[model samples]
Target: MPLPRLARGASGRPAAAPRVRLPREIKVLLAAAFVIALGYGLVAPVLPQFAASFDVGVAAASVIVSVFAFTRLIFAPTSGSLTARLGERKVYVSGVLIVALSTGACAFAQNYWQLLLYRGLGGIGSTMFTVSAMALLVRLAPPDGRGRVSSAYAGTFLMGGILGPVAGGLLAGWGLRVPFLVYAAALVVAAAVVAVMLREPRNAAGGDGTAASPPMTVREALADGTYRASLVSAFANGWATFGVRMSLIPLFAGAVLLAGPSTAGLALAVFAVGNAAALTFSGRLADTLGRKPMVITGLVVTGLALGAVGFTDNVPLFVVLSVVAGFGSGLLNPSQQAAVADVVGNERNGGKVLATFQMATDAGAILGPVLAGALADRLSYGWAFAATGAILLVSALVWLAFGRETLIREPQLQQRPDGTA
Candidate 1:
């Protein structure tokens, strides 16, 4: 039997859809992310230099390193709530708008505090777009294809991370403020693409079935064990990935590997590439294998690999470790997202839970640079990086010790004759 298109109209009822065929909207969904990444990346390498240009000390420049994360962490939980009240499409678009305006504002800033304000505003946009985009991905996808769907979204960001540095370096060579201009332009392009190409998926709206209502607050989602575990896993992953990679890795490359800034950048890019390549496979793997195993394994191996990266002094060793760490990170996204989807399935509460998860991720992102940089200053980059890895290892073990898989072939978990809550 033939089925309806993946994106049905305004009605919330998802019509029966056919077996796996990638929807057109997938490209639309991933489009804004590329623009966002490019703009952020263009200025990323030299943000400290920009602050320093204003006569600020290294300590003040650190805000350029951390404000983005701080703002995101604060706003992530709110994304879902806002989206549920609105809709995924509006939230996603609004986010792009915010980033565009914020970047434009940054380009004109002449002082340290002005730049800080702009960067913080951009974080709000990032959170708004991410939470809604993710919720939409969950809703649009068929149950069987959830992993790949998320893998595609995750992969987009990964690819963006790859391109950001190469682009950032070249643009930074041109001018301190050119990157911001480039970011604004790229965002315009992304906004256009999403608007023209993407069509909203109606079925994934709100919570549960048409009869059910989405939770009004983030507090509601936290009360559930399954949701809570997913948040913890995401936070652990983000802390290890974002915190260590941006803050401590470059130092490790220069000090231990005897490399330069470019080498350090390449090492970071390798991590993104590794995760992106893995996404090509992990999506299908998640469908066949399920989500928790992938999340647990990703957490464990990433930690171990970070420890190895810290321990090694050789350039070749760092490269290999970057690839492995990225693969581990690649595993965490789809599995954790799928778990969120399992609980959020057929529920409009997608916005609420997605927001909560983003907060966890944001918290990690916020903590990563500041905390890692602090540790590096006090102790060593190796210690700063390794500690995050160790944290992941412990977090993974906790999940495996007590957490159970959220989704198994739906048939196996179907309710039996007995009434058990």
Candidate 2:
């Protein structure tokens, strides 16, 4: 669907806000994202166990997980350059197929090293599709509806993350390798869907319609204060959300709270519940109230709630804090993404810019657990959580002090000659 045009008032200003409608391309991308995330979740729970089955020790098995991320970090820039040269549609399809091949290979691996190599190869493909997808969104998403589009996209991934594990666990009853094959099959379907359905934006092409505009460089993006703030926030988000949440939360629940595995699972689920609830409306708020406010609010709420998680001994309080922190995360993500989209705009490819932004987050996810784990070991869980919260709070302060709002209001949207906004 095309975005609704702003109706004018007697004074020639936009009379009221138009309803947000997503375009067909974004919908297709969302479907693809769901399939990709679900396939990923299918493997996540079983990967370590699968690695251990090859006679590797615990740390070695764990390395299987880390290698994927490490490769993604290193390969991101190459992915960005590929997207710029090949176009998002081509790169996206190829990336999905690469992952499919690697994942399928994982199912037949004869030893730990083979599995490691295949999994590491998947990371290269992972960044290829990831960078391309973000670029496509920047090109295709309507200016007025970027936040809502981002929210919907994120929601699909969350839903898939929730459902994939249950299905994978059931499939695991067949064999550890079954899930890998299933995931590979799912990726193939996703790739087919995108290759068949998604199309590049007309504006992305030159006057001859033979080529795309030059990609926005990392140097250009870095010149913007908002983009810089985005990197900082992205890092903090990775540190707290991806790194600490996955690694430390489970450990803390088990060791510090004296909670069972079930409780830790419940805490994670509650966080998802809270995140889903916020996603329902946060996008619209970001569009209307502005991205900067939502980001700052999310940071404060997440920082305070997540920071408090370690200080409390009560499991109930811990669960409550977890939910609150998730809500804050939901609030922050769409706005942060929309702000970055604003910086990139829709005029040119943001491949390198988006890749750099992704790298910061990936770096945080990689480093946060290591450093935070040390604090947890030498100090205490309280100190670790406190430090995590402090990081978020510090980012919030940065935004409050220097970040600019990136939402383009209805009145501000420029109309093209073709009548599209």
Give the TM-scores of the predictions, in the order they appear: 0.84, 0.93
lDDT of 2 by residue, 175-277 (tens): 9999999999989998888888887654546767576567789999988888999999999999999889888899999998888999889989999999999
Tell me the spans in candidate 2 whose CA falls farther than 4 Å from its real position.
Answer: 1-16, 208-212, 412-421
**lDDT of candidate 1?**
0.76
Error of 2 at 211 (Å): 8.2
Clashing pairs in 2: none
Worst 10 residues of 1 by lDDT: 1-10
Residue 30 alpha-carbon offset, candidate 1, angstroms: 1.8
lDDT of each: 0.76, 0.89
Write the residue-wise lDDT of candidate 1 on 95-142 in tens digits. 888988898888799888999999899989888988888877877777
Q: Pick the candidate with the highest lDDT.
A: 2
